[model samples]
Target: MTKFNTTAGKPPIVVSDEDYGRLTKLATAALDRFPDVAEELQIEMERAQVLSTATIPEGVVQMGSTVEYHSDVEQRRRITLVYPGEADIAEGRVSILTPIGAALIGLSAGQSIRWVSRDGREHVLTVLKVEQPVASATPTVV
Candidate 1:
């Protein structure tokens, strides 16, 4: 089992070992171009329960997962979480480097996160569903 550093007083988050490594490098690389979002992602990772994908709990969000979330500032939306290179707002493919993307990473269905948007507006977002892409490398969570 994995553990979260609750001493940080934040909600628990999970991350696959593979995602952790890649996202860490991604965060570092995005520092110059996306400092705020990158820093937010770094903080989420610091409190994450790092594990292998097979052991990732059912409903947990990960790379390539399609997430259904509700926000205090906007209507409910569904989006596929993807790497920055794959992001297309028109296609509902969101980048994990964006504020909402960084906020959604590692969250499970029913989990809610409070974060600030790029425009400096604070928002609360809740994950209503998580669908791992059928073509993903990791086994799908039930």
Candidate 2:
């Protein structure tokens, strides 16, 4: 089994209660098809500090948050973290079920984490910025 950095020394992570509930269901359902990734997601969920959606800090990475991160191998990249069905790598939307995605959830800007990829490659990613979704937007009717 791949061992991720989840010890006491690592930085803390916070997740919104709504996101946690959705992700937990998703992870549980994925266990039969993708046990490894599902297990990792479960571990992350278990270690996360869940809070009310309104109480979660603005900079924390959550579903639909656009994150700018620097990776050991990939340098810098900005990606929007989304659900499995919404994932489109070509469009820079990463799925929460992926290794990097699971590792990023609940982290705030400047927080760094080391995670192992499915192929057994270790990577360190530091979140540079987090852009949370706007709560309200005006609709333009054409």
Candidate 3:
């Protein structure tokens, strides 16, 4: 809680049409509990270029994508962006509802974004790589 930053003319973002509907619901439902982030996510979606899953080009950051990026606060991070239900920071899974996760959405390799942390510090991150989840990344059981 109490995370996220204000960006400068946020770069355009994209979302799978399939995910948009569910994400809309998520943002609306979270309004009561996590207003700031939920609202941030909602605002992102408002401008997102939603396309069919099949039309979504590779390397675009989508749900379940394992992205490698460098941020000002950290040297670099490689994590999978997941739905809130599946987020387990310990396992390198980040929820879409979190600040960083929300920022990572729709970004592709070589794209950078700037944001201000709660303490009024401005930070920038560049996406180095994006790997969409494969069937192997999902295992029904151990």
Candidate 4:
């Protein structure tokens, strides 16, 4: 598999210590489960810094401005793309463990990636934008 290259001239991203810790833990566990795969992911995740959407706070979204990548049969979808806390499929949020999620985790807007499907067709997508959760969007009783 071709490793995605990090872009140049990007600003440093900011992620909370807690979120960084969580990502580290998750990456560690993944490394144990899939040594080679985990090794690759570890390199990406460690180098990644989180940057949330305008609406969301840095601590809450564990996301960065960079794009991540993954490829697997449909069966591996759920495990790879969604966030650890956002595994509720009904909500339409995917774990970073999912292929698409993996492909998007560290990318910023305008970045693109290429991956192959089971049918041997190449697929590519660019980060049009990132919409992190915003604190103001949270409803609170007055």
Best by the lDDT measure: 2
Question: TM-scores of the models, in the given order?
Answer: 0.88, 0.91, 0.86, 0.52
Error (Å) of candidate 3 at residue 114 is 2.1
Cα lDDT for residue 84, model 1? 90
Error of model 2, residue 108, in angstroms: 0.5
User: What are the clashing pairs of model 3?
Assistant: none
The C-alpha lDDT values of all candidates are 0.84, 0.88, 0.81, 0.46
Query: Which is better, 1 or 3, measured by TM-score?
Result: 1
Query: For candidate 3, what is the lDDT?
Result: 0.81
- Compare candidates 1 and 4 on TM-score and give the better one: 1
Best by TM-score: 2
The digit string of per-residue lDDT tens for model 1 on 73-126 reads 778999999899889999999999988898889999998887777777778899
Lowest lDDT 10-residue stretch of candidate 3: 133-142
Candidate 4 per-residue lDDT over residues 26-124, each given as its tens digit: 768876654444444455566666444343342222442222223333322222234556465665566555445554555555555554333445567
Off by over 4 Å in 1: 1-9, 136-142
For every candidate, C-alpha RMSD to the true structure in Å: 6.0, 4.2, 3.8, 8.0
lDDT of 1: 0.84
- Give the candidate order by descending TM-score: 2, 1, 3, 4
Relative to the true structure, candidate 1 reaches a TM of 0.88
Superposed by TM-score, candidate 4 places the C-alpha of residue 85 at a distance from the truth, in angstroms, of 4.8
**Residue pairs in clash, model 2:** none
